[model samples]
Target: MLTLTEKPRRSPKNEQLNSCASSFADYEDCIVGFMDDLQLVHCGHDKKCLGCGEELAHLTLRGVLRGSVGVIGESRLAMTEKVVLLGGRVCAVKRFRQVSSGRREFGKKIEHLARVSQKCEYLVPVAAYLYAKRIKQHGHTALDWNQRLTIIVQIARGIGFIHEQYPPYEKKMQMNVHGNIKVCNVMVNTDFSACLSGYGFTQLAEPVEVLNTGQLMKSPCRQQENTTYSDELSQKSDIYNFGVILLDILAGPKGLEMTKGVKEKKASMKLEGGLEFFEFYVKEGKERRQVSKVLEIALACISTKPDARPSIEEICFNIVEIL
Candidate 1:
């Protein structure tokens, strides 16, 4: 038995942490889980690290991962949307193109990657993955107010869980979190529940100096020539994206186009009390109040300043309160 009284820190590359994971399959329904890097995290965190158990998918399992969750910088893997297996079980698959790691090494990496993020129910579990390849939601706004609201809450909890976990190994200093959270990428399962997909896949788009009101750029304090790629990948940027999608759900596509210069703090206060801006429909004051709570969340998520955005944990907590 090990006798160190202190907490277990991330073990060095040469040493593997104790394996605590069983399997990645959540067989209850059609819902998949949150997409994240296969990175290991210390178990002490709110979401324990996924254990290093049977997470490997061999070339033999090829064609299984027709679609992948997301990809890293050059880790560039091929991707598809989804595939239905022999048993009527549909799965998301991702195949990698340029991965140079051998079989055993690749398995080790996947096993270590998710040991910390396996516990969140909001995150759909991976039944299996085949490395033979390489590599990764929206649209839930049309249902009744209750269904729409439930999806919004589920999404908030999923992203919140992601943000609560530490930034992945390569992202700690660069500070990338979720980086991508839009509507088309939000997956709805057999039960009609929602879970965020396409997480952590940082965009390689050019640094944008100006963004639409719907996609607010982080407020800049320094007068710099341009924002770098790393600068645009923070949690605040993700919040802005989430806000845009939320607006899309409430107001539809064309509505957000006119949101040119709405003031954040002022607009938020008005929205929480009423849905005057979006023309939403709710049966009673209580129902309206509950839905408006989400409107407030969208505003906070899209705050102009990075420092002004609420942490994911706060957003999740607020969503839970509304329920």
Candidate 2:
């Protein structure tokens, strides 16, 4: 398998892991704006923001699994909705399980991750996370198909952005690759665009919460029924993760089973076999062809051989072609 030494075909600019974006809020739009706009531009952060100066406090949380669930190494997780008093934007605050690190360490890590992740749009910039132990419960579709296309494409671009990062980033942040790329980690906006979250903190941040909006319900990137998280990860693993997400998009209720079948040699990764599951989404013959192409792309992503797996850059280009 080719290691970190391999260069991307995306171009000389991608060599530096650059793409168009002045800020993280505008990243989804930036994905649409460029592949041509590949240049590592520094995203500016507020120098005096309180979030940037984090202070950690330990919480002995015994979570109620009814409204939320996730394994955070020691404890269970619960979900609560948060409203930013300043902007009135609804944000979900899910309290995490057992934390092994000191409060100060956790705070520093969040600040560091936020500061470094600003270089790109697809890799979501941290929007001030609060470590409130959730004492309460928590909280798409397109016009319709176009939004589906938009969300997936943005996710692909985001993953592609991660794959193209310079080595210095991984050294600085401790995680350059997205260790977890599950359905819940991809946040959809009110505008139907999407961004990848839960990155860089394979060891620290337990993505116990899922940010929801109208686009999430019908969006292909809905939360998985039996979600799993891991820390021992790689770029190829990310391809597999993304493939499973694509499978979920196409197969819905049968996604997990189909993924198992494909992995365990029980299922065929043929277009005809996959098409039956997603038939409702394809209205016209052209749309069917696009879906077919996407299914193939997903299969390639989950290929068993590490070398056989397509890079995120390749996947992004192919997905863009389908759109």
Candidate 3:
């Protein structure tokens, strides 16, 4: 129900205005969509913000999100009745904080993964730039447990691309892990293909300048510096997490059983005195072998020692080859 004037006042968000200008130059139509936090309306077609007059609209929200998408930590996922520019098919819009460095480097990482996508056939690759959300809430929510009842999370070809493009040595040594691979961080296309989405957790052990000491300190950015090696992250970490994701997609303890496991683990992690379920997978004898090869892979990747794991490339190759 928003109104537009005859003379067309300068928009506060130029991207929205420019998109409308490009699409409906002669039509002079006032687009009706949700405004972002910056009070800019994203037209979605060309991303021209109708509030400000800027020609930067590559990353803007179109409308309120629908379907089983929601926030998982700092990320947001939602299915919308809009089309992504890459393939122009109706796709779910996902938003998360860009990698710690900046958007340009992150975009380059996506581009690098896309450039060699043909080599890998098992993973999905992201196809656009990462940008701040233009729309505040577009009414999006996380996927409910009952909604994804089948536990069938779709992984895209991007992982395969990463696995394939990496040199065998790097693959064996450390194919560059998907540091925080999880169900919420993956994307599914119309074709049921799955792709990795969150790379913000990926980090390198870099030196930081200590102002007081005037010396460089090596800082490995994993949670508590729990890295594979001296400031190095390996693909095995990704392999391990991916295996967990596969477990979630395949079994995931479903229903009341899922809730029960959750409560128990929550208590255990908090030292509130509960059964240590994480140790359940480490049982010896034939019982251990009965726990599904997939689960075993997950446990192995999550082992305390970095050197005691298989690389992501090897893991992906094994999954595609074995199962």
Candidate 4:
């Protein structure tokens, strides 16, 4: 229920946000090296970039999937892979759409977002260049493939980073709202570290197009235009989106039924009784109740009253306290 009169921005220089201890200090040097090392080769623009026109030798921590299957709003989001420096300590990458026409403008935003990403762990940085690769669908894993503990901790830390913002960047930009957030957008590294990805649903200077799935996919954060809530694109909205993701993680694949059951009431329960569901199905024990609390938080975030929603700072504090 706690709220803020104004949004709290992330501090760029905070040690937690800028864990990247690389010797490269100047932003330009870091970007230049990252791009050069990528050595991108352009394959033709196909849903799946099968033929690598000029394939790079190795995959950097992040790059674009030639034709990734992503959906946004009513449109299937089309994205190009981009690798970004994270906290200066880790490398995080995801598919993104460039926002500007000219390289200069594009460079500026990428630099800005990179610094912002460094400052605020919640928002991802824009990449200097994009590398596209073919994507092959992987079969579903065994049911025994439970969540990795390290990945869970990484997600907690990543969300924690978003909650705590650093200094100068904090003073300049308002709290960033990740307009569209979902499980598909979040990535877990081989080491089980998680990073927030996909900022295309946010402020973009160019035309917005969803990745073409050729079929409609539900977008959790779509808002009607010219509404009383013109500020629907605020940071609180991102919080709501993040809540959905948290539910996805906590509920796992079967968790979708919980949501559906809530809606339909007639839907079959994952367990025979509510008590059994709470006792056995929910893994985190006491934390399972917290999912509903988090759901309530998401509800507040998406409330018609913009003023009613808690700021990122408040949400962070509450979540940390609860955890």
Q: Whose lDDT is greatest here?
A: 2
Against the unseen true structure, what C-alpha lDDT does each candidate score? 0.46, 0.51, 0.35, 0.37
Candidate 3 wrongly placed segments (more than 4 Å):
1-73, 76-99, 102-110, 117-121, 128-160, 164-175, 189-192, 199-232, 253-291, 313-323
**Candidate 1 lDDT by residue in tens digits, 158-177:** 77776666544432222236
Q: Could you tell me every candidate's TM-score relative to the true structure?
A: 0.55, 0.59, 0.40, 0.48
* RMSD of each candidate relative to the true structure: 15.2, 17.0, 14.6, 15.2
Candidate 3 residue-wise lDDT, 197-226, digit = tens:
544234311222222210111111111122
Residues 1-323, model 4: lDDT tens digits: 00001112236576332321121122222245453434332222221222222233443323222112222322223332122223221222232333333544444444454545555443343431212211101112311123332333344455556445443233223334454455555555433345565443344333355433322323322221111222245555655555444434444434433654443442233222332222124344554544445544544554456577677666655555545
- Write the number of the candidate with greater TM-score, choosing between 1 and 2: 2
Q: Tens digit of lDDT per residue, candidate 2, span 191-287?
A: 6667776676555544344445322222222334244433346888888888877766666535545655554442333434444455245665667
> lDDT for model 4, on a 0 to 1 scale?
0.37
Task: Report model 4's TM-score to 2 decimal places.
Answer: 0.48
For the record, the alpha-carbon RMSD of candidate 3 to the native fold, in angstroms, is 14.6
Q: In model 4, what is the error at residue 53, expressed in angstroms? A: 24
Model 3 Cα shift for residue 304 (angstroms):
2.5
